[model samples]
Target: MSLIRHAETSAPNIFHGAESDVGLSEWGHKQAGLLADHLASRGAEAVYCSALRRAVASATPIAHALGQSPVVIPELHERKIGPLSGRTRDEGWGVYEESKRRWIAGEVEFSHPGGESFADIDRRVRPILDDLSKRHKGGRFLVVVHGIVIRVALTSLLADRTPADFDAIAIDFASINDLVHDGSRWRAEALNLVVAPSPARPVA
Candidate 1:
């Protein structure tokens, strides 16, 4: 059997918490439960999460459903946003237009004020991917991590896209992306997918 790689964006996090232990917000809790149900339905054998609370909480319900405790990997943690970690989108440099342009241009070399560049994130996540391949061959795994990390991983694996193309891969909170690892290569199976929202409102 081929290895199924399910990667998820962690729940929405509050911009609070000290440098070491930021956690999920109230909305994140709700998102985590929904994501749990989503991942549970896929029936992964091993549930893995980043060291952050948001990722851990996001993976918890699914882990329970599978009767396994989540395996936490610090390497899976979100890319460090540096001093911008708790700042609002506008408060950060390259907030709106320029950032998007840079991203689409495949430039991962530029750094944020106190944070890292896309290349930095790629470096951190690459080793993790290698480890997963070696340790979990022919198995299904769910990785609960962050948006930037997803982008970096995709940038590394995609056949026709540069890091800049990652700008268009919008991974919402708790959204899931799918991939597969054959013996030697990794392939993306799908991009961001949201669970269909219940139809209780707007109709055509």
Candidate 2:
């Protein structure tokens, strides 16, 4: 299985939540094509994506390239930012950082207002993985989703048994992380395949 983070979003740095309608940026468009070509070479059996627009846009071209329709799974969405939906970067990151701190300290129920707790993520995501495992069963497939979703899924596979790990690891845009599921167990192969690198963030 292959997990690909959706290409650079129109709202690239904000705490884009479930309700965020941000699509791809101009550079993200080109990144999508890069991802498409890479997946085309790999010959994926099917292409799946989060319901988010950016994720869909990211997957559509790749699906077209592979002659398959992109499947949108609502469960594959990123962690919901709730009240922090459209905050400035610093403000949102401030809330996000503190939330992560409390969450890592074992406060499983801690969440931004109207947002998902870490447990909520697992509860929603497990079914998706279970459904996919049965449907795909050893088949190589593509899932285009968000950075945080991939981290939580990978952490779950590693038996971390936690609801959150906001700082899990940095997964760049348009990157592919390879994994394999043999009916019961799951394991990752490669990670952070930067197909089209974005411009470096300016120094703060």
Highest-lDDT candidate: 2
The segments of candidate 1 whose C-alpha lies over 4 angstroms from its true place after superposition are 1-20, 93-100, 196-204
Candidate 1 at 165: error in angstroms? 0.7
Q: What total of clashing residue pairs does each candidate reach? A: 1, 0
Work out the TM-score per prediction. 0.79, 0.89
Strongest candidate by TM-score: 2
- Residue-level lDDT tens digits of model 1 in 1-204: 111122222322333212435555555556566656666667776888877776777677768877889888877767665665665545553543454467567677666565566777778778877777667787777787776677778777666567767767777666677877766677777777765222212322
Q: Which stretches of model 2 miss by more than 4 angstroms?
A: 159-168, 200-204
How many backbone overlaps does candidate 2 show?
Answer: 0
In model 1, pairs of residues that clash are 106-164
The local distance difference test score of model 2 is 0.80
What's the CA RMSD for each of the models?
4.7, 3.5
